[model samples]
Target chain A: MESSSNRLFSARDLIGFAVLIAIIFVVLPIALDGFRLNLFGKYLTYAFVAVGLVLCWGMGGILSLGQGVFFGLGGYCMAMFLKLEASTPENTSIQSTPGIPDFMDWNQLTALPAWWEPFNSLFITLIAVILVPVVFAFIIGVAMFRRRVGGVYFAIITQAFAAILTILIIGQQGFTGGVNGITDLRTLKGWDIRSEEAKEILYFVNGGLLIVCLVIAQYVRKSKLGRLLIAMRDQEDRVRFSGYDVASFKIFIFCLGAAFAAVGGAMFTLQVGFMSPTLVGIVPSIEMVIFCAVGGRLSILGAVYGALLVNWAKTSLSESFPELWLLGLGGLFIAVVMVFPNGLAGVYAEHVEPRLMALLGKSKAAAPDSAANETPAE
Target chain B: MFSDYTMNELGAIFAMQGFAGLILFSVFVLMALGLAIIFGQMGVINMAHGEFMILGAYVTYLTSNLFADYLPSVFGLYFFVAMILAFIASGALGLFVEWVMIRHLYKRPLDTLLATWGLSLILQQVYRSVFGAREVGVSIPDWMMGSLPMTDMIEVPINGIFVMVLATGISLAVYFMMYRSSWGLQVRAISQNRMMADAVGINTAWTDRLTFGIGCGVAGVAGSAFTMIGSTGPTAGQLYIVDTFLVVVFGGAASLLGTIASAFSISQAQSIMEFFLSGSMAKVLTLLTVVGILMIRPQGLFTLKLRK
Candidate 1:
């Protein structure tokens, strides 16, 4: 059990599997049109959220219903930066632009307010994606976790935070872009987003980021910190007996998840070139949790798979029969929850084992779950 | 017309805003009470709670439509009947969900949030399919419409008085049901310790269903009543969910009195500020204040701890 050299997957095998994933994602842009690419871009942003849920929820057992708060925080930060960059240097009276965020016109606000001056720099905006959510999360997490808030209690608190944030953003029409939110950005760093090269670059970036996150997560899943996290999730009191600072671990994982969510937000803003309060709210936040649950929260790739699949279904369902979309979504969750308590990945682990990673061959000598009962801290 | 009131008019302004605030507080209390019952006693987060309220609103709408067709002269009385019907309809659904879905997942509260959230979306779409997308305005009966005669400067709306009275009466009835009744005793016992109650031969399953139904039934009544102040639409429930959640949570999970107090404070702050500031600004101020207060008292306004 303690052999250092014997590992689940060798470095070469991981690289090969990564290559196959790269090929599929890298080829997708060429295979699909602009509209489809845009839709996938939205999915990628959602996957950003899934990545975080994998840690905070799957591993830490923190059923945070409002990852959207972090997602929105990041999105708003990027949106603010994008808006600044898009603004003319001369402060020309930006004419009655029809789709130019409704808040700007509703408040009859003239020339960007003084508070918005700093977001003008793209670099700062980028930095804010990480900083704002981290700070907010740390403050919130520390206060709550220190009190040993876990389970549904923790979830409801986070939801309330998201709700308050949403209401504040919606009500503060001028500053936060209100209900309509920020929109109508022309470019990012002078690169035409419409160009094929730019689209491919975005795709590669999203895909690469996803894999890098996967690797980091893998290491964390196996490390002592990971075991400690799982231990914390199962029984906090016991972990305390084992001499671990449960509060710090909770905060660390929570912050790591938030940071990943922000990165997703940044990439999403770059793709959509806009952000709205609706992007991060109670509704979307709950949806992210559902995605993780449905995909099997304990598995990293399962979360990614769930995010992609659920988003695809949402898009297609809403577009196909707008009337039945909600019903279909609800029914799907019911079926998933009722049928697969461990989620879709659990099904694969049970039945379609050899088929999933077929590239590695049917009877691979070693596989993860090297210890069958041992669950990864996803 | 919208500027701050003159010194002479300030008393009248405060009186009006205060009355409006009271009504608003009543609505919050009603909404939060139902949620508190479900969450506190049952340990379940019913995300579709707003949908149950919508069902109540629809019932009221249907009752209005029925009265208009059958006996237009007796239309005002339809509200009472409609509220009962909505209570039954939504409660029946709550019972069904508790028995079928929620019962199995009793130990997993977070999962219930997602499952119910999905349920809410489904119910909303169903309402949209049936009610149509446009906001449906319920006709306030002649007696209920317009304002009550008061001093020249202070004219309180008839509906505001109606809501306040109804909220107080219903909340009292609910309190009686929860605190003073045998059924409520069983519910309290179950909430306190499920295994102990089960050992004591309480009909735990039935209690769970009935408690959930009552919570939803209260939500139904709230929805029916909300048709007076707010618009009736498929998505109307979404409007109150945030505010209701805030009130319930700020009041703490275990205390009903806290719910009432929290509602009173939040609503009063909102309405008073709205008189001077814009609607949005008032909301921002209220939220900032609540967040600050919650940061201090994470257990909420009235933290009633028994088990711990």
Candidate 2:
């Protein structure tokens, strides 16, 4: 196992990771064309969301179907900021717009609500991007976890939360952007979103953020809590018996995952400069799962990989077949589960763990009872 | 005439809203029943449950198309055949899945979730390939489509009543099967104690597959019924997954009584709220209320002895 650890840390795996990224970057540009690369930025943002899901779902035994809640939370937070800044009397953006936003006009609002105040500041917007979702998750997680709501019940409840949130946003229309969602921003920090450079920068920024997330998740995976999370996944009862308050741990991870998703959602809105009720709805929330599923939800790398692949396939297929994408994406998922069940990350983990184990010469000590601790997880 | 008109308007709205809730209740019941069988009988968290329901819906869509083109004169009657075929198709797919994959992974309940999720994606894509990506409107017949007039002012949708009756009858039949029949006894025994059931000479494998088949089949029935009122698309089942799961879990994993109670409560609450408030606010309030209540009572309406 010492050799295994050494082997795992070998330069080859590092090279492999880089090579994969390089291939993705090169191939996406070539195959997708410039216009398609514009769409790839959105896929990258979704990949960011997939990472959040991988944590709560792939690692922890929590099946969070409402990740879109955090994603939308982040997007709406950013949109609030843009709307505040863009609402100046001199800015044509605010001209002809009634009371507040057009939706609010319809809702018969006479003035901007006080809650809309902090949104004008980029600083406050950044703080809100993380704070709101964390606060919401904290409250909800505390409530649900204290009572020990879990399994299919927990997943369903969270999903309902996502569905209801979208409806609420749409219904409020004025403050929340309603069905039209927040759109047509002039610029993000003086860079035209419609410009090619801005789009490319958005892509690189998303890609880089994904990498940072991967490293942080990796650290977490190797930490004490990570192993504890695995234990919780395998046997929460046993873990609880071990004297750890299981609920707190779940709450901690859920909050962390929400933050990650919020970051992604915030960046996504910055890139696209739009937010819509559909983005927060139940359907897109489930689509996040497909990204995790095909990418191998258990692996950080798999989460991003799944996101990029599924979204890429969707864009390409939707363009060519216009309608064949769903069939293809669905079939691909079944095939991956059937043939590549480990997911891309699972496949990576298999080779990386063994070789790294051999290189580090740790396998020699990992002899008889090692298998007992190697819990096979979902 | 003035009193009659006023009374008629109120009656019509009430009837529409009331039956809409009933239809919603039926959909929840069918979805939750399939999920409960798998989760309760096999103890596997089959997250792909919604996909199965979607499968049934697509089958209904095809059946609708087939009838429209080939059996025009008897188009309405084709619905019966479609329902049966959807049941068989989804059930058969379930059986194939059990044999090919799920059988090996039941021990890992949560792992099966991810695998089945992948399987769901595969199924959805297959549907998209065969059908198209855009929503498919499963056309109902004239008799099924029209309304039944109760008073000059109040009209009840024929389809809504038809669905409610169909759901009630199917649910009763399933209930009888699970509680009254020999096979049902075998299923309960296995779910209660799989090792012990096998020790007692019950064919555990056969039971697992059959239960899974029936679960998926019921989902198909639910899916087909959903097409009557809901949108039909490659990913249509995604809409009901949460509601269905909520009903099953809130009801209690293996308890049919729990499902019905949960379904009735949630649907009625949602529908009534929609009548009073905007649709979105109603949904938000309903969910928030469910979550709030769940925060206190996690085992849901009925407490099952998952006292492991």
Candidate 3:
């Protein structure tokens, strides 16, 4: 694993990471205004989910369409804490139950639900933001993978989970914020999130967190486990025959994806100032998959760019000609799958990177090395 | 919950709920039949299935309006014409889609899912642009309107019975076509062993196109049937996509009988639960149960054993 990790990180990998860091941390902030920067921040949050998909769907070949379920769980956990902080007795004096959330009051509840009580403490909420989704993913992963469910069956079942979670959230309106979601989230422990300064700060926080996660994702990809995941993906029965507990590896990768998505969801709440059932549903989950696909399913860095590019396109296209956005996205999906199955990363690796490497004789040695390793993936 | 009602009232409630369940079952069966054929036979996901259904529904809508405006005296006969037209319109589009898109994705099942999802999104936008965002309803003929009163307290809508009959007729027709015809034999042969079927002089590609077309045409008919019980909208098809998929998967993807049986059980479970709980909760429970069962039995309820 160490030798493989060392071999995986060429000077090219460092250059890629450096460029990504500079763009997110330096270039984007300097170029865009606060509003657009904030929107990019929101998009970056989704990049978290895409990066996770690279690990789970791209590397491991386990596509969980219900990543939104984990994202929603994490976001809601954070939002609950924020909501509780905002609903201080003095803040909600107009309500019948002053200390409780306005929705709970509107629904005629005098006391907070036991489940929500834990979220009042920010530490517990933070832990829960990551823990809850990972736990849920563990249960789902254990059940399905242990029973040898993979491919289309696994995809459909995860989608069904997304459907179930959405309905549950919408149905349990009082507790989960229903269709409108938890709104009016003003402060995070006396620091107002609504301010411009806070938004910029949260953007940096999001960018920084993303880099850290990217490092972790790259580490996983370079690890023996990563190669094992690829092996299992290409030939599951062969991997299982060679003394590997395939289901355990699958469960671990799935839980890891859920944790990443959960963190992203929490950051989404912080930066966006609200979390809703809308983010936790089937549509958003599938959209997240497209982000991974468009970026280059197999490339971690490409996924981040993919998320930003897709969301940016979505915001711009839907803003001008709302009807055309769906058409465009649909067309993009077809183009991505039919024409460029490897996505942006694949294009870069095949076309752009090779040309660049040929221009710079230094890259010639590493090119053949990576090309040998990626033959199976091709 | 039972203690709240008197014995007679409880009996009436059960009967009423059971009848409602039957209507839901008809809908599931109608939708799932087409899905089972496409998914089970050809191994294409066809996420745009609901859109195809909506195509049939829009055709029905157009046919109904045409009858009211140009053939008022023969309006009662417009439905049969609409069903036929819906079938043709949807089948043609399905065939076109198969040729252009689905043919390219035979080796990659997961990519097919994503590609078809893209197709569904495009179809949804097309429908939205053409039909507008609002839900539209087709007017039923005079004979299809009103209800049949079985008892003083338990009355069933005539349209519910009509949908049931339509579902049954289509199911039987599909069964006969798939089991009792040479085309069905060809389809079965292709599904069982494509290379052998090709070597034996069956045109595999043509059969695939027709099978896809017929599957989508059945969905069109199902959508036509849907206009009886619910309104039509561009995204209405999305609401039922997961449920229909579950029905097909739960029934054992390749077996038509399994599809019907799974639809029956799911719809009944959902409708009965709806009587005692909120609609969304009932739906959540039903879907959760199906998913849980599927995790344990991933092959579905009725699997046909095949060589690897």
Candidate 4:
């Protein structure tokens, strides 16, 4: 019951965090050249989402399949800003409507649309990046959680949300850049973002923000509200009977998860320089869940590893043999759910950690005790 | 929006769109009925539902080819044979999946969703590999190719009528099987109280398998009928999965009447709105409405009374 309020970082947790930091911040920068490091940085952006999933789905047991919606919303918000800046009158001097985006010009729009007006301001766009998804998450969370509609039903509804958003984006091609997405992103507030230096800077910024998100997630996990979330997840009625506002907790964590995902989305657009409906759709949303599942949904650090490893595998496999990626991903989904419900983190905690402890001349009992202590509060 | 069209033109437009909506409704009903049975009865989120439908579409495509090449004289009669074969093929696959995957995750509904999603991905890949990535079209037999001239401006396609008839017949068959048979009682009994049904000598596992199979079989039939109105592709089923699930969910999961009512309303709304707005805006509005209503009424339009 008091597990949430335990030491914020056990020695094991500190070591894991340190190792994760070393990989993301130090080793990768040294080993990989510019392009690959930028790719890893993109993967780290997704890690922010995985960390949020670790809290929302792993601990709170509220599986939102539409995390991509939040991510996309965040990315688009930033992309809108970058796109507007890139589509300045001087930048598009030859177009019929010099101030408007090229896609809008192609679609025969004479002026910048009303919605695109606010995005011209960088401050507003930055605020909108986080606020848009958080608000959307709040509405969804409050509506569903308050009604106590959850489990597979919630999962399906969220998935439907992703589908709806994708369709809307694709259908509104004139405004959204359609299936091609918001491309030709060139600069951010006069800084030429297409430079290799900018890519490296964005990569570091993405990594730095991910680490910040990790700390925030760790704080939430060690807080009393985290305990309440676990308590509600495992036994909702019990928490309700105990006079706690179960819905409020669920809504908070869900919104928090959305905020984290939104940040990741913004970072994704920053590093990748594009935002599209493809990333904001049903397939990518579900794939995001797989990242959390593979990493060890229960472990925040594991989530970072999960995002890195899965994305790494996806890039390498798809690059070589695109046909095998889907098969491998499908097989991995089944294997993770059935064979390793605890995921990579679970495997490590159960098998590898104990062996490591023994080799360190420490008591093996401690490893099993920690594992048992983290049994989702059920 | 109505200012551009006079009364007669508006009437004609509404009538044409309404008929189109009815055809869409038939497709929705066909798709939703199977989902309602599987999701409501078995508590398994079969994300591969669309794939099952696509399997039927592929089966129909194969049967059409076979008739075209091997039995030209009976090409007109190939559709009926195709429908039956599609049902069998999809049902068999559903049964296999139930045994291998679904049964293991019955205790974890969320896990079932993920596992079945994985299953959907694998099935989609298989279809893509076997049938190629291109969408396939069945040759409309000579008899089903023309249109019925209801008026100068309101012509109806024979294929649409055929699909409507097929949908009605299958829906009636499903109604009979669910309400007027002993098997359906066992299914309902299991859905209501699995432990009690098991204690009362019901073959719960077998019933579950059969229910899943039947659901997939129905989806196969839906897919077969679908080829008349649209092209079939490896991922065709995915395009409609969300809409079908919405239909089932909006109708109240366990209620057949609710499913039909919801499907009718959604399809009609979509078709009618599509005529007035852009196709994407219409879809967005219709889905947004359904989702909004669902948020407010999560049990859906109708819910069965049961003790928790």
Q: Count clashing pairs, candidate 1.
A: 0
Clashing pairs in 1: none
Q: Write the per-residue lDDT of candidate 4 for residues A1-378, one digit (tens) a residue.
A: 245237777666688889988887799999999999989989998998899999999889999999999999999999999999999899899998898889999988898889889998999998999999999999999899999998878888999999999999999889999999999999998998889999999998998899889988988887788777777778889999999988889999999999999999999998999999999998899999999999898888889889999999999999999988888898888888888887899899888887888999987354533553265432
DockQ, Cα level, model 3: 0.71
Given candidate 1, what's the lDDT at residue B293? Answer: 72
DockQ of each: 0.43, 0.45, 0.71, 0.65
Cα lDDT for residue A217, candidate 1: 72
- The DockQ of predicted model 1 stands at 0.43
lDDT assessment of candidate 3: 0.91
Q: Residue A49, candidate 3: how far off, in angstroms?
A: 0.4
Off by over 4 Å in 2: A1-43, A93-99, A102-108, A189-194, A200-212, A290-298, A322-324, A335-338, A349-375, B1-16, B44-82, B128-146, B151-153, B224-233
Give each model's whole-structure lDDT: 0.79, 0.77, 0.91, 0.90
Who is ahead in lDDT, 3 or 4?
A: 3
Interface RMSD of each: 3.1, 3.1, 1.6, 1.8
Instruction: Give the docking tier of candidate 4.
Output: medium
lDDT of 1 by residue, A1-378 (tens): 444324534453365447537544765667778678767767877776786787787778887877888988888888887776565543334545332344575677655667677787877787888999999999888887887877776787688778778878887777777887887766687776656667667767887787777777766776777777778777778999988899999998898888888888878877777788887787788788777777877777777778878988888878888787778878767666666756776776766765655755647533454343235331
- The best-first sequence of candidates by DockQ reads 3, 4, 2, 1
Off by over 4 Å in 4: A1-5, A366-369, A372-378
Write down the worst ten-residue block by lDDT for model 2 chain A. A366-375
